[model samples]
Target chain A: MLTLYSFGPGANSLKPLLALYEKGLEFTPRFVDPTRFEHHEDWFKKINPRGQVPALDHDGHIITESTVICEYLEDAFPEAPRLRPVDPVNIAEMRVWTKWVDEYFCWCVSTIGWERMIGPMARALSDEEFEAKVARIPVPEQRTKWRTARAGFPKDVLAEEMRKIGVSVNRLEMRLAESPWLAGDEFTLADVCNFAIANGMQNGFSDIVNREATPHLVAWIEKINDRPACKTMFAHSKSEFADRGRKVTA
Target chain B: MLTLYSFGPGANSLKPLLALYEKGLEFTPRFVDPTRFEHHEDWFKKINPRGQVPALDHDGHIITESTVICEYLEDAFPEAPRLRPVDPVNIAEMRVWTKWVDEYFCWCVSTIGWERMIGPMARALSDEEFEAKVARIPVPEQRTKWRTARAGFPKDVLAEEMRKIGVSVNRLEMRLAESPWLAGDEFTLADVCNFAIANGMQNGFSDIVNREATPHLVAWIEKINDRPACKTMFAHSKSEFADRGRKVTA
Candidate 1:
């Protein structure tokens, strides 16, 4: 039995959801809403000591980290549809993109994301509610992020975030201009990992990621949007907030 | 033919070097000295657009990122000694530790490391010389990091870095207490990746990572130090500076 615990169709959660749909795998979706502090609950903590979402439980085995879980799905079920490149060289190319997303791109987008959406929700909470929620978070850095979001990200920090985002967009544009996907011809997990964040750009970061500024990225985003699996993942969104920064092209 | 372009026994460079030694693979080592700005030169940029070290050229295909390079080595050379777990679940467990080190542990350590090492090197440069070197760096965030290091990291930032390091040490201690290595019984790539950084702690952050405070971690370090491959990698160190933060057990 396979079970995936995730939040709404946000950045990290979108990864495995889309991959699972693409791979045509059957798994249970256990939604752990972060806005409601469900992820920090003791039950969820038992599942993942880190208390983070997008964790996959495969036959009594627990795998955390969205990218790692997706890779696990590919590794354990070789009979399933392939999302990774066959050649080790191509796979290395794919991993470089995914690693870049994990280390750099995701953080830049998530920082801006928390500031815009999560910041407001956190600020709306009562002082006691906010403190209680912050106290329950397992990671110290995450706790600091929550407290900072509630208080407001520093002006310089926010500027640096946007700057990083701009760089990511430009690099994506440059890469997509050369090939159909981030890792050459194939639509591998590199695309799946990056599209989660790139999908948010048309609506959230149109100032820097629009057609005029980043036509290749915009085109790539539309291509991924056309996939049937992408639609299925979007349909799984729980609320309008889940589709907060996503714009569907007709 | 495998050729690895890397620096000395520093954080990222330590990973591929140790993995190559452990796997018993022969490869050409193209040492790129960052201190001399060789990594940022035009010749090196052709190999890796990011102008970062620890890039592997497998035949004609080039792979960047230290962790990704190590994984590439595993995937391409199944005949070599295994550094990854055979079971998918164990692989996932191994990955969680490696990913955490890549995303969190390494940055905290590198931040402090840069302030102590790179800051003085950068500060010692002539104004024109520093500006010329900074202009050659491909990544914007890296440029900002170099500038900040030269200017000196903020006191608040350095304190936060130390706090993160303390958390990392405690987590390592807790995990080591349970198993012989990071990912249970077998010494996987997870050990190789973290050991690159953990090996530095004895001489560098001795205040927080000593045997008195973290006996399990200390024992694990000593165990890894006893490995023939570990000794081989350390022997390849270019300068006394390469052994700056490493303490050899008597």
Candidate 2:
């Protein structure tokens, strides 16, 4: 049995979850809470030295990196709806789309969503707790340097990221408008990758996903949300997140 | 004949060039001068809408992105030396290494070599030429916002990037120490990727490749430099770059 270590709202974990769901593969999901720093725990570190989530422990061989894990799953289980086309041209298209998800989309979500939204939210906490949380950031020296550098970040940086999000969403809308998916007429891993990032942006940075700026992207998101598998995954994740929140509150 | 649109001294273009050289495939290299922003020109943008280089026009089928281009070449010309492994495990390893090269290594090199080193080099030009070069930055707004936001970027951001280069060199050294190639015991695309980056670093940032800091990496660079394909490609690129530089200087 494959054990998938994941968290509720992380887009990185969503990649593998979507792949598992898309492939209809049975796997055990062990939810991790980054707020609690569970991902950085010693045991989890043993599983993934990088201490990042969405790690697939397949028959004891650990595979990290969301894209690599997703590709591994696609290769290991090729029967379910082919996530990738076998033809070289189609494969090239898929790779470009996948790279876009990682390079452009992921950057927006992480910077805009995490910095503009999550970091401020976290900072609103009690000083002691906030300090503890900050202390727990992996790679403390690097994180400190980044945070310090980020402190001087322009006030409009968030707005600029939002604009890029707008452009990205517009592009996605154009792509999805032409074809049902990011790649083409078919649903593939490209859609899965896009969905994860879109969901992250929608949840964490809703202002960027408004109909005015990104009507097509909003519509595409709604369409994907209608999928039973996607719905199931979201419902499960939401419930799990709420349950975990309640535990912390208690 | 395949048409490869590329700029001199980019790791992305080197992947396809190395593969073509290894396979002895015939292709015409149309060099783009970054100094002139040729890649973003209307003609080149038709080849790659993203306005990035290393775009290959193979019988009218355009392919971009280094890894994807290499994979496409491998598939299209299987008689060529195999770049990817056949087994699932080996493929997984290859994918991870490839992603590492594209994501982490490329980021380090660009942040350190290009942004810090090359940008300053380009900026040290006549006012008209410098302004023209600066105007060509793809995401001017985003770059401005990022630079503003990182106003207090550790005075040592460049130093930090250089340190990462050291770390990268160390990792590569260890890998080469274990076997003649990056992936244990076999020379695959991984070697090509590493060689390209190392070659660029040596040519663009020699300080990072000192014998005291990374003797093994230095040795590995020499070994890769000795390869017939590598030697031929470098000689061709060197003359081309010299000619282009002289034209620009004139």
Candidate 3:
């Protein structure tokens, strides 16, 4: 049996969550709500001292980091509906985008999400409560980020983040114009990873992401959304994030 | 035949270079010297559109991104002397650190390296030459970083980067004290990816990384340096970086 410690379904949490659904694997989903700062709690930290969500516990073994967890799933269970391609060449091509998601795309998308969506939710806590929450965070850099999110990011930083989103959109469009999927013709773990964030940002970046601006990416998102596994994954999402996913596909 | 487009023996480039050396695979090394801005040249862009080095060409196939390339090497060449552990549990553990290096550790180390080593080299180019080099860079974000490095990172940014380095150091010490090698008793690609940076930073961070503060990690670095591949790879490094590597192992 497998267990996934996640923040419902969306962002980094959704990669492994959707992968499990795609592979038709059963996992006990233990939700660690970041909005409530439950991840900063001691019990959750015991599972992952970093206090991040989307950690996987495979029997007695533990794996953290969504990208690592998704790859581990592929490695441990190489069944049909394989997330990565069979050929090494295509797999190499697929990883370029996955690494892009991990290194560049995720940071730009997360910065925008935090500034707009997560920050407001985190800021709603009282000063004392928020201060205590920040202190409890295991990593110093993460603590500063939470504090910054609560305080509001600088205008220049957010503007640069928007510009990066535009760059990300351009990169994705360039890829999708040539091939049906991020990696190539077939949907793989690359799609699973990219879709999670692309779907989340669709409504917010509608001006840049609409059918008119990024036709290929728009079509790709719609097609992936219609997949049965996508539907199953969305069925588990919390209301706020679920609404965003539904709106993007609707 | 294999072809490696690399920026010589630095952090990111060293990952796959050392991996190939460890496997005793022969590859023609084509240095895309970033100091001369060869990565910005059109021909190199054909090999990798984004023009980042450490891209591997296996026969006619292209693979970019250091972490992805290392993982691909393991997948395509799953023989004896595996770069990653064979056990699923250990591989999962190994990936955690690899992902950490990609996500958290690398950025901090790179920031320090840029401020201390690479930035000065880029700054040495004349104003007209630097502007020309900057204009040739395909990606906007990378262009901005190159410019920032030349101008020097903001004091607060550098300070925070150092703090994160401290966080990384503490985390590594905690892991190394428990396990003989990162990821377990068997050395894995996690070491290959990480050693490139840790060894690179030893001279600059001597106070923080010495035997007193981080004994296990220091010993681990020494043990990895003792490997024939590490010595061979370091022997190929340019003088400034070579001096740093030799000092740590000495």
Worst 10 residues of 1 chain B by lDDT: B241-250
Model 2 docking grade: medium
Predicted candidate 1 versus true structure: per-residue lDDT over B51-102, tens digit per residue: 9988989888888899999999999999999999999999988998999999
User: Which of candidates 2 and 3 reaches a greater TM-score?
Assistant: 3
Give me candidate 1's interface root-mean-square deviation. Answer: 0.7
Isolated chain A: TM-score per model? Answer: 0.95, 0.83, 0.94
- Model 2 segments more than 4 A misplaced: A116-160, A237-250, B115-157, B174-180, B200-206, B238-250
**CA lDDT, every prediction?**
0.87, 0.70, 0.82
Give a tens-digit lDDT track for model 3, residues B102-127.
Answer: 88899998887778656777778899
DockQ of each: 0.89, 0.62, 0.74
lDDT per residue as tens, model 3, A118-187: 6776777889887888899998778888888888999999998888888889988888999988878889
Q: Tell me which residue pairs clash in candidate 2.
A: A153-B149, A154-B149
Best lDDT goes to which candidate? Answer: 1
DockQ of 1: 0.89
Q: What value does the lDDT take at residue B5 in candidate 3?
A: 86
TM-score of model 3 vs. true structure: 0.93
- Which 10-residue window of candidate 2 chain B scores lowest in summed lDDT? B145-154
